[model samples]
Target: MNINVERQKMADRLFLVAVEGEIDVYTAPVLKKELLPLTEISGTGVTLDLSRTVYIDSTALGVIIAALKSAARNRCRFSVVGMSPRVERLFTITGLMEILRREKIAEGDN
Candidate 1:
């Protein structure tokens, strides 16, 4: 299936982008579109809520990584929250978790 993207302004500088459904090749661009611009703004804290997301392909993963990198470069905070067990395993086994751990981005998960 496609995806649904919902954005929320949590604070003056904190934005929450909640993605539901599947994030695959076709839908990854949508996720990127919603995410990259937020990272471009300096000091913007972007939290990606994936609680409702059930599936994500490699393209989507790459988009997420790129967003995180952009957030790091722009000095904006980026973190992911409420990942499902399957998706969480993908992040862990692919070493993306290590990359996230090493990067000085994203604040508390809460």
Candidate 2:
């Protein structure tokens, strides 16, 4: 599994976290540790990129929700992007799509 975090310490302070492979119970903690710090930085917005992720279990979802809550408390913007079809289905089934912002894939692109 590969987890990459990109933080822009500029006006608006954009933070992008990208994850590859499965994000299950074991991997969720690693993600949590990485995600939590984004909220600590002053003036930040977070974008979680799951474009390369193969799977995400309930635990992983919980961790993400927690981060969203933290972003709210800190008054920082938060959104998620690059969701695969399976992941998108899971989020839809779980009703998480209502709360999380997902970047739309352009037509004619995989």
Candidate 3:
């Protein structure tokens, strides 16, 4: 499947990536390329909004986990938000929900 990834800088220290469509092996690399750089922004906070995502696989999860680790090493805050029920269940099943900071972003509240 395919995915569309868009980004917005919410503030001097806040960055956001909005993803739509499936996050599978095919699309995971795109996400990694976009997300890893954001994590390198020292002292910044990076958020991944997956509200519109329809699917995710292990490869996608790995990309996110790598980004999370990179963020930690760079002193950046990384959060994953707006997960649909199915996606949230995956996170729970994988025990990543406990590790990831899950928060919802209100419309226009960035």
Which regions of candidate 2 deviate over 4 angstroms? 1-12, 101-110
TM-score rank order: 1, 3, 2
Alpha carbon lDDT of each predicted model: 0.86, 0.74, 0.84
Which candidate achieves the best TM-score against the true structure?
A: 1
Summing lDDT over every window of 10 consecutive residues in candidate 3, give the lowest-scoring window: 101-110
Q: Candidate 1: worst 10 consecutive residues by lDDT?
A: 101-110
| Backbone clash numbers for all candidates listed | 0, 0, 0
- 85: Cα error in model 1, Å: 0.9
Look at candidate 2 and tell me the lDDT of residue 56.
90
lDDT, candidate 1, 1-110, per-residue tens: 77999989998999999999999998999999888899999988999988999999899899989998798799998998877779878887888866776774433322
Candidate 3 Cα misplacement greater than 4 A, ranges: 101-110
Q: Show where candidate 1 strays beyond 4 Å.
A: 104-110
